[model samples]
Target: MRFFIVISSLSKLLKYMYYIYTHSSMVEGKRCMQTNESSKEQKVKVSGLTFAQLKKWVTVDLGMKPYRAQQLFSWIHLKRVISFHQMTDISLSARNRLDRAGEITALESCDTIAADDGTVKYSFALEDSEVIESVLIPDSPRLTACLSTQAGCRCGCTFCQTGRGGFRRNLRTDEIVAQLYGLQSSSNDRITNVVFMGMGEPMDNFPALSDALSIISDDRGICIGARKITVSTVGIPGGIEKLTQLDGQYGLAVSLHSAVESTRLKLVPVAKTLPLRELKRDMKDYISRKGRRITLEYCLIAGINDSLEEASALAEFAGDIECKINLLIYNPVEGAPYRRPDTESVNRFMHYLYPRCQAVMLRRSRGSDIAAACGQLGPGARND
Candidate 1:
């Protein structure tokens, strides 16, 4: 009787062990499947598509009605919904289909630092875990949101902290528009102006920039006026030509730190390839085609490009084109071998160009205290 009882006990123990092992294996398999699905979802960035593309995808690819496309567009771009589940107007089956198709990745606000001034700086977390920074400058009636076009810049402008970090990758069109949407959602004030002057060079990422412009300026979408959006570049001739070809009424700002070719080359290494004369001609052509005045962004670095002579050269360069000169005192970047001009020097420099240029405005560094000022944005940047 004792032997029979022991035998029964052993059988029960063996069965329990087998069940535990099988359960563990099943759990592991399920986890692996979940990971694979997550990765697949990451690959399909629905936000990367424009409204028109999303409409086509839904109507043609997902076998949904054409009207559903408009709803989807409004939900993502206008409403800024993070998930298809939040799209109440979309049917359950259609939502599931859209979910299976891809994921709608929105920019997560990692950190936001406000300056003593009314400027607010936001650090956005990308889908790939990379971070980009944007600035919101509150100027009473007109609130300006400065947007970044690339994760890091390759322009190699010595004074720019973004270039100091080296290039990562150009931001997609959706990523560009996401910045505007994110800002609108966060701020109480409406964004009246958008400037591509945050981190990277806009012209370097022209295709994405153009698409973003279209979505932002579209009345059916974000509804920002084309004139209110300004794209700043370190002078790319091909990009200027492309902008002219598109006949976009968007404003253009050239980062002409120094009007002299050799001086400009030193300041903007990319200028070595894109000479001042060629860039000048392209600007003239763009002005002629678009019938809009270009803004010359001159970062006046003390003892470097803030000399009266450089200012005069800049005035001469602006002679033919109807342009406004935005004289910005260099915002100090850590490790950058440059300094901001004193009040006297800044005034002197602007005084020289004031007579020659169409209009000259001194741009005060808004978020310099938080490293959110012009030429001061990058991973390496720190707030003082």
Candidate 2:
């Protein structure tokens, strides 16, 4: 039975490796096709297109005036109108044509659970009925929307519940943006900040994540400030390089739960593929070019990464880069072996890093009761 279990695990790993190899080529092929064909002719999501892309679809594909595109974009993004019929200024004929050609991707809120601390977790049902979770965290005078980039995570962080479910697929750009809009509409509060720190790694779904960032930060759309938006990743070097090339003052956060490679690899299985040294080099380059301080998110797990030695190593890792360290207590997930660090250990770890690190803050895990805290989103959650 032990040998059989080992073989089963090995087979799953091989399957995942094959998926990764083929997925890249598939994305590239799809991009080429999109560039060559008219977007309107393709069954594209209306919410995914930029103002410029919409304008091209309107003027070139639909044979309408360019001004109509601005009106359509305003209706969809600014007004947060979901239905084509609600676009009052757009002619009925055009609306009918649009209704037939494309769709506005929207997620239905199937379940909502609120914690005592005002953190609300939402399970949104996609059009296909697959569900993904997002959290709305309320800090006084600041409302932050935590959004997901993929349906489930592929990053096999041992402590993370989301990865235990395995990877489903990447969320479309519109699906990514819709979480913020849906949360704002439901809560009746303005989202002051948006963080890609839920469910999936933003870097793994770079194209969709990048497009979502563009739309959310666009002055003509949701218009959230680039500075207010933060994208967290498990230190993907290629994704960091791509983000640096983009034209925005976006915040970058790396999930470096441990500074030592051996410890990190044990915690985050994906770390073996992306070495700590290479990620730090990319992060340094990103900081140099952007002239901005990056954030390193470290989760303090009992008997795992929360130690005086680990804290010292982490401070040393943050030595070269301009960064702020956000130390989070591990939010326990069902069936996970790790536990949250005790108060004394947590305090000791923070104290050790205080002198060596420029800025270090111990962030309390919120919404744990509702299973909405960091690394606790997907275990036993209702999907249908």
Candidate 3:
């Protein structure tokens, strides 16, 4: 009876912890919403707003000069300053006024790990104490920063560690932008490329992602060109359409783990409603409108989606569209049932896929030893 009571108490404690961990973000969001509902003069979070929005906020809302917005924007984004006092050129009085009327928000970097292969993973704590990860992959000329769009993930891809962790909350625009700037501050190299392929699905947080893209690509600020950034999605509904409507030519990569619809359904559960046919149509539309080639990412998992027939199916799927194929080897994750294909299987699969694809490249897996590879990112994946 004593042992059973102890076990029951432990179970209840675990359940309570899980509830607090998962629901805090949402509860905090609701609390903020309620607090802000009645207050019209609440301080604006300056980090996330675009220059135009900042200009309006300063001039109309704060009764300041328009050019100050440019100065503030450059400081918040280019300089990566967290406090208004860091804006050296701005008049002390203006800085004081800005501090009173608005605030610069930033993600707190909790843990960092550098892999043997020069892949650095950064873990950040959100306001609600939810944890998310970003990765800095060093590619000499182009240091790429992998930013997360949401805290956890709603798209339950069976092979992805992030998906298995389940959903927490969609990150705000500021949180999305802060990841790039956060990584930039930590590394010696300025990020030349940005990939929204870390903790959450980008399309699920489209509004924030859209705003972040504009701010990141804007010449007035951090100014990483749209072409240098890639937004990867698991083919969520209306996501491609929304991207098509956006102004910039930011690159798009689809996580097409399997070309066979049935297989994809099993792997990426989100693909059930948004089938391969619909996804193809959307991709075609994006190419037609954007005039940019798409990138198809295929992770070869042993006995899952890695086979001669799978390659054939992939070739057939890409045959109609203009896209480059990036074949990635499945990276090992704790508690995942999937296995990386053996050397012979991978070789055979690539050989069969090479000529059939519009363009084919076997992307070398990076940071697998440190859990920073593709689809191997999440809060639980962090060493700390």
Candidate 4:
């Protein structure tokens, strides 16, 4: 009787699986899939706008006086208005007009994790009910905010906790910029640097990421230089090519955790889709056009890809490319098979890279007490 029941369940499960495989395309073609975008009209974040765009918006759309644009910009960004009603400097009539146009980005701070070392991790609620993380690291004189470009990641890097969460959706420019506002407004330590190395792949969400960078770089606004901003990617082709067209002096970091193609594919699965040879070529072209050095991030894992031979190969791999190798100590994640390499092995690997390229062994920052190290930020933390 038990055998018969088991067989019946197996048969039913197989039938459903067969139907899903056959009709998968039909499910994908539906516009209103699972996202909340199905209900509310998609609104851009106010933090994502530049003074020029805001000026054009106020003058052309709202039919406000030219000087009013400057006042509005001051009220929103400089004053850090928490609510629309707080834009008291702007006339009620004009504010009502702007309100009707759906111009404001409604954001609510969800949660914050402040480490003993003054590193604060903030989670912001998006209009779509998805949450993204932004981290502020204050090392006295140098304050850095690690920002995210998407709600979740699609890069599928095997070593990453956030990437394992799978792709949710691209965050708007406003969502990205709101992170800066949140950090600056909440913390006393002013952020001097920003790195797009948090939750999602920055290059994948190119337009929104670029817009967020522009808003931060605006002189009359936050006024952060392009040099102070670092955009990291898993080596997307179209994104890298598009980056060449832009004339910003921002820094770029490539997550080149392994030099070996097979090993890299095992770690960063995107390598299978965008292989190293082509990626190297696109990156070389980017360096030529931009005329700047790029940072190659290498994560050292024990007994896996950190052997002396692999280190030597990595040196040869980075040869004369206008690049610097950032040897990162692998931040251990729960259920991850690999362990962090010892100091001896890490030094041996750095010795090989030093001869071939400009290299620096960036020590993992504080926050291990709170589990905020590299690849360690997520709901799935090791209990042991």
Candidate 5:
């Protein structure tokens, strides 16, 4: 049996190795993966950081003046330079210091699966040897990258595949930023939008998530507008408060899978601790301050939360908060005792909510081919 297990692990590793070989692009006489290896541990100067806590490196450690840091910031954030060698105008010695002391490029792309519908799902190995998944969905003119914030989720939402695996560790800011860079670097299509609706709850990994967002929204490099990035949380009020204090505009989405407390507790166990009332109040306060529409994400489960009464309750909940509603048809996961809401039932739920609040059916990109769809991330069980 021990020998059998060893063989099984070896086989799985070999399969993943083959996948990486087929997916990785070779350029300039070096594989992209090779460059990633060289910079993995460099201190990663924070002068013009897009995400994570790199500014401390500039202001505190680097001993550089604020203006110089600002300039470096612009070069790194605006220019999106992958290496310090690209900071041409800076002194060679200073550039060398940065190159040796600092580091970037954390997420290493292990494999990519491109769906027929122009959706691309990527698996990334984090610095700590854990894997997370991200998805890029192309909708004609607008392209959105769905990024994950954690290796696995602890929230344990019954319908989510990642949740079933239980929570691991939070991703570093660089890990988060690396996902965006990986997708943008490989694909011809530029990602115009981003969503924190991936493997882990954004609130669960607040510091890293916020740092990543700041960098992504920075005007210097990747320069993705703050308004184009949406951070989705499983209703963590404290994290929401921190977000509201930010200066620029960014969107928020709450996963309120069910309206009733009893049902919600079963669907999302964290609901018992956070509760819906406090979450609704905080959301209302945020909306009143920002004047931007808030989105409530409701995943409709067949015969569970899709009944007329539940729909009515959901519509009423939206009316009370004066927020927009995005209803997702539940994605089936292995061993999860849930089914997608039928189209007719989904339409009826939308019909009920439209009068009370802005409601739209979210068309999700299916990615079962690569096991990269919603609720489809986690280490799979060993096959016999």
Candidate 6:
């Protein structure tokens, strides 16, 4: 396990370079860069901001005292207040002013499913009416929250259902944070960890993703330690480079479903542009700079990427790079051509690669019954 987590923190893990998702209000089907004039006069959403950012906004923009900022922080985060009227300690006048200036953004609960395996999945509606899902995975005392970075995904990994639904707009910072707030309200087991491995690729919406990370990790806020958070990506070169620059506080998981170039291209269409060779270079650079090992995630699909030849390639690919190869059994997706490998095939695949790689583990899917497994999130699934 030493080689599995040679370096501390997820700062060195996850993400890709280049993004097609743009942050702009749709104007006649055109997307333009948002402006500082309140995004052309849209009210601020205070839910996802860090304490320092909240203080600056309250003191400067909202004309509130510095101490009042702390009060708002406690009201919103510690107390988990949903509306301004709930802040009884704050002056009525202040509450009225806050209502006029900004909103304490919260998601509207729509539907939820509890898997027999103790995995609870929640579907919430965003302000724009986009539906996103989050999963609460129970493992004894530790319950992990898998949050989404976007409403849908841009990286069209053929094996993933989220990609099949096509990309929607990138989530605002507040929307990203609100998922955790929504999950906490539903689950009794204090969320012990978070994984940005839900609906979309974390790197496609890097700006909002980065802001949500800081806000989530801040002691005055949600306070989930950075190391307990993991950001999984499809190995974007630019995103990997940027992840290395951040303070090593989180874990990194790259969804390298296949190591062979030809097979990987088919699995992750984005691989056509961000070839495997470059992805490895940045991964190596991430280790050298952050001194942390990344977890290479490979989802074993029947017949497609489960061959012994693929195992040999993966071993050779991760040979010099310090990383833990995490093997996953494919979870079924509706309308997808792929099939889950049988038990014997999975055993053969895992055994062949276990000795060849520096470190390896077969991470079982937790919520297949409720369609909450990895690569199974998206629209068009009828959950019972």
Better of 1 and 3 by lDDT: 3
* Model 3, global lDDT: 0.87
Cα RMSD of all models vs. native, in order, equals 10.9, 16.0, 15.9, 16.7, 16.1, 16.3
Angstrom error at residue 171, model 3:
0.9
Write model 4 residue lDDT over 124-199, tens digit each, in one string.
8876678777778887788988888887788878888787778899988877877788878877767799888888
Q: What tens-digit string does per-residue lDDT give for candidate 6 at 1-384?
A: 776575533324421111223322221111222323354367678887778889877766654667878888888877789898999988887786677667888885798888999898889988778999999998977889999999888888888999999999899888988899899988766888999999999988888888888888877767899888999999765898777777755788899998899999999999887899999998888778877788999999999999999988998899998999988898888888999899999898888977778889999788988989899888975445
Global lDDT of model 1:
0.83
Residue 201 of candidate 2: its Cα lDDT? 89
**Residue lDDT tens for model 2, 198-224:** 999899999988889888998887789
Between prediction 2 and prediction 5, which has the larger lDDT?
2
- lDDT tens readout by residue for model 3, 34-151: 3234334666778989888888776655556677788888898887889999899988877866776677788768988889889998889887898889999998887999999987
| Structural RMSD, model 2 | 16.0
Task: Quantify how close model 3 is to the true structure by its C-alpha RMSD in Å.
Answer: 15.9
| Backbone clashes, each candidate | 0, 0, 0, 0, 15, 9
TM-score of model 3 (CA atoms): 0.88
TM-scores, all models, native as reference: 0.87, 0.87, 0.88, 0.83, 0.82, 0.87
Alpha-carbon local distance difference test for all models: 0.83, 0.85, 0.87, 0.74, 0.75, 0.83
> Candidate 4 — which residues are off by over 4 angstroms?
1-44, 106-108, 382-384
Counting only residues 3 or more apart in sequence or on different chains, how many pairs clash (N, Cα, C under 3 Å) in candidate 6? Answer: 9
Q: Give the TM-score comparing model 5 with the true structure, all chains together.
A: 0.82
Candidate 1, 22-100: lDDT as tens digits: 4443331212234336655464567767677777666555546668778877877778798999999877866766776
